[model samples]
Target: MKPLFMLLLTYLLCWQVSLGQQNSYTGNGQVTFSAGAPLDLIKGTSTAITGSINQVTGKVYFEIPVKSFQFANSLMEERFNNKYMKTDRHPKATFIGEVTSFSQNSKEVTAHGILSIHGVSKRRSIKGTLVKEGGKFILKSGFVVSTKDHHIESPKLTGGFMAEHINVNLHLQLIPENVTPQVATVYPAKKGLK
Candidate 1:
């Protein structure tokens, strides 16, 4: 009986450790968006992005607070939250899906998931690079968001200050759940990304 009990305890501990190693969470994630038109350009960035990933299951998830984004101009920020995004009504944008293809040797990954923004969800496939460094997995990706797809109407009243398409970039450093949390290295957006 004592031997059986010890075996069960060992099994449980191993299972728990494996599960923890398979899952990771972002310590500090950054999300940025850029929209440009012939007349003007709009850019915003947020450091409040949060998410988790399971390497074993290939499941990935991320969420960004709508109001967390900051703009260079205060008026533009207010208009973005209240008039455009209606952040009070829909406070978060999220993506939930799985990594369809990933190769540790190649460091290339493709994820298929549902991206939700402005209360609308759309199926999407996003390609990104993933690298393991210093006990962390770094993810970087860039994609475009269409205002029409998410029902974000860009009024002509601003004289084409907003573009119909917005380019988004993400940088995340994820640490395994079992590991001690440490300060993540934040990478700056690449030049000419817009």
Candidate 2:
């Protein structure tokens, strides 16, 4: 499953190359999730994230390795990986989509795409803030994920300690792509370069 996410990312990069689009940015991001229950709260965070966005095309992609998420309690982490997420089998969660109604000057943007997790794929539209500062693009969003939708079964042994809905948060900071395609460029042709 991790290989599949890698393949998808590679394919997107190749697609960018094929389109001669260099006006892009790719970098490491962060993902955090929190869930509330009657007994206690569950929280985890992961920094092993990679994502990219094409400035000219409004395309976006993000990938998260399941095992990268860290929990405060080792036992919870183990149970999360072994019983809930099954990270050994399905190792990644990914999203690929296009930004709609986006602009560098706009404060809010939306990305509509498919979210694949736990071997289940669903169409999800995420709305977030888009901030451009010092030549970097920052995107942040918060959303909810239903465990049942992704086939992530909570342990009945918890005595209903887990919530059915998981709150997810994402943060990405990206800089413009420095490498440009040799044949076709993403940005418009400069004067006398045509």
The TM-score leader among the candidates is 1
Candidate 2: C-alpha RMSD to true structure equals 11.7
- lDDT for position 70 in model 1: 96
| Superposition error at 167 for model 1 (Å) | 0.4
- List, residue by residue over 1-194, the lDDT tens digit for candidate 1: 54456666666776776667756555559999988763566789999998888877889999999999999899989989998899999999999999989886899999999999999999999999988887788999999999999999764435545478889999998887765333334344466652
Please report, as a residue range, the 10-residue window in candidate 2 with the lowest summed lDDT: 180-189
TM-score for each of the candidates? 0.80, 0.77
Clashing pairs in 1: none
RMSD of every prediction: 14.3, 11.7
- List runs of model 1 lying over 4 Å from the truth: 1-15, 18-21, 155-162, 179-194
- CA displacement after TM-score superposition, residue 132 of candidate 2 (Å): 1.0
